[model samples]
Target: MAVAAAVIRCRRLNIPRAFVISMMINAIQAAIGRSMDPLLTPPAGNSLHIKASSVDGVQIYTCSGGEWRFLSASASLVDSSNSSIFIGTYAYVYSPKHVSAIGTWSLNNSEGVIAESGHAASEVTGRVIAFRGNKFALPAFLAQASSHLFDGTASLVSYIQQIPSDGGVPPGSSSCRKGSRQVHIPFEADYWFWTQDRQPPSVPSELSAIGLMIEGFFGTGHVKYVFNGTSWQQKNITASMYDVPGGILVGRFFIESHADDAGGSFTWEVFNPNGWTVTAKSASPGVQVDGSSLPWRLFSVTSASFNESFLGPITQVQMISTRGGLPPTPMQAQAVVETWKIMLLQWSFKVCMKISDSECTIT
Candidate 1:
């Protein structure tokens, strides 16, 4: 009955005529379609839930009582998050750690850098953090056209993790690390939870405004581009590529990629200003004449996986091709929404209300 009333509202003479809407409406039937208004405008308090769907797939956003957040796990967010928190899906090429470090460091592996694995591969996590509270979109990837040349003698391994430098969670118990169990993440600078909308009298214009701009390296055996809020950018010396010291840090991933001979030289270094012991290891035996822009190139093994949630599997994501609608003309998006509303009315009348042949009663 309420649907019937909604149809009438859409039909008011003051409103525009119904038009054929996109297939996105059907895609988001489980959640509010992107065309719909948010349930909460200023969102009474905080932690307001916002979900939208389109033909591409579903996206999620939330006001975390203090700010809006796009639920995603980046190399940084994972450092403090619980093991259960959903990180976005990942996809990338894979390769074994070629050689051991030939620099000044050891292998104690503390903080978010404790690694038990010997193999290394490039990686790419989901750029968007759209997901239901604990659920998320499974990021997909295009396989590398041609993978790197592997020696076949190298061994594959799982992700690396930190052992907790602050003495661990159980306090004094060495095995109790106080952060997420993910090991692949290198440092906090490359990726992080972007909480820009903490205090909001003015709500964000779009969902991307309140999500994670998780960063990763590109080219050097890593994913091609890193998400930089606006779009995925190719990794270089940019923040998305090289994180500042003292966070979840990975040395080899950065160094290996930027190296000049591009292959022959291997060096690893760990710099933690907060008192975490610095350690390095020469996986094989390196130390060649190197000239990477930054002595150390971000080295990452490639890997792939999808973001899955208890709600449903996210199959696709609409990427910001030329970047987002930077200069959002007021009501530009709203116009499409209005069109959708009219289409919805038409659908409800014909399918549910059983009204037909130009007979869509006002009530």
Candidate 2:
């Protein structure tokens, strides 16, 4: 009721419906983040948390003899943009000794993520890339780096865990005993990827803003130049990365220059294409940039994404170096928007798609 009233008030105040919806979603997400169970915290130490995504798909099952046995699960891993990033399958392996399952994932493309559009199937026949994972439970497990079958993005992943699931339970025994058949039970769950690496692989930043604009054509890469004052000029930008996920590329800056512009005067908004809604905030008081007289503040990612293609899953991003984009002081006469240059450092876990069998161990 309160939310509905607030929405009505916002409409009366001439707020954009899209903006209002975005604000409400962010607020609700924040509350959900706060309510997460502390007991499910990722393993501590040097273990870096990387990608977290929601999985939407079906669990495959086959009726054998008088019972329905697990078969395989086929699903697509979606990002915040509602685009499928990874294609995954969980296949049950039957052994006279013990039953196990292997989970596999592949990049989504004509061949997918790492491949070009409309690429020929014959050209990449044996080169079909996928990451292998272990299954400890239904739609959940830990895949160690040492267990990866084919080397690639998955080779870099130290572990993966899925929790907080809904649906996908098999039908009752009465239904299974009726006849032999195959079934697909729909399910949704959250997945997380982890790695030992502290940062994602670096790609060259655009030397010129125009070049950055062109690069954005290839993928989600983009350069949004934010202005603080009229004097702010973006000279050389050395941090135009191309291979990072969508949210890491979004650099939305809001600045109002005046005498009142002091600490915590700026705000940045970033959205994850992998479905993780995140924001960046001022990390410190004004810090001196190399060429600019006025100091620009630093910001860090409050949240990140799930499994991405080349960079795996982004865990964190930091604005290590910056230039310009500072608000005017009281002594300065002109107060207008200006441009800023920044170099971003991104961290993520290496993720891949493949399947490997191992003893089921729930953790």
Candidate 3:
């Protein structure tokens, strides 16, 4: 037969190759057309080409039959039963329009919600609030004024200075300006002294009848007197005089040599108004009045020469000669005798005196 019987070459059937080819084709088809539930789905043939979404939550993709079904639950939107929701301690649940019903609420000790004015009538405002001790009012009048604000160190110093110190008088008080006036006694006279006297002189002699002023100032007493001579001298007297109140007179004197006569001398004595004696004797270069161990008194001798003179309250006088025991001289050493005297005078005066009208008997 002319049929192409001859071309029937017997080729060995490649079953293993065919099987491998069929398996590859099946895997490709599974990857392209297979669909599965996410929970029960198997791995895709190719690496999954999953497009990532920007949304944050639990997302699931399922391939069922031949189409992709995406399932997602957004944490922000989903109301999951087992979801962790943190409710602050201070959170209040009230209708949005009914803000007046909201009150201070605290959860645990941490979070709280408080009213704006801390009053029941005020609306609840603060979120994530805390109860710090007690609530206080918003200072309306500023506990103080802005003008009272201290801005600098100088202002603060002035404010502190204005504060009254302890034991101090406040401003505008009468005692604030009250002060004690201090009166000081003048001790200019070199013969100034004072004492307490208990007796008076027996007679008006050179050793007595001398009164000293006893003035009291600032709770203390003082006596003062003047010495005519410029130099201090020793006196021969060691007894005290009992005279005026608070007067104790001791003999004290200053001596000087005769200016006109060589080897001649003069002595001065100051006697207390009470019985007290003071005698100045002649010595080389000058007369020395031994006033050692003398009591306190005040006296003044205006003149050293023994003479009959009356000056201000001075009434009596005495004279004594010191030239008796001197050595012989070429000329007749006539003993020069001098007299000394003292006067008493009132030194204080008062200008006015007030008598009660009821006590006054006017004639």
Query: Which numbered prediction scores highest in lDDT against the true structure?
Result: 2
Q: Answer with 1 or 3, whichever has the higher lDDT.
A: 3
Look at candidate 1 and tell me the lDDT of residue 303.
17
Give the alpha carbon lDDT tens digit for every residue of 250-291 in model 1: 322222444333232222222333111111122222211111
lDDT of each: 0.20, 0.35, 0.21
Q: Report each candidate's C-alpha RMSD, comma-separated, in the order given.
A: 26.5, 22.3, 58.9
Model 2 weakest 10-residue run by lDDT: 209-218
Candidate 2 C-alpha lDDT tens digits along 125-214: 011012322332344444322234332344344444455366667776568765557888887755554444332112112110111000
lDDT value for candidate 2?
0.35
Q: Which stretches of candidate 2 lie over 4 Å from their true place?
A: 1-42, 46-56, 80-102, 107-140, 149-151, 198-363
Tens-place lDDT digits, model 3, residues 196-245: 11111121122221222111100011122222333222232211111121
| Lowest-sum lDDT 10-residue window in model 1 | 344-353
Winning model by TM-score: 2
The TM-score of predicted model 3 comes to 0.12
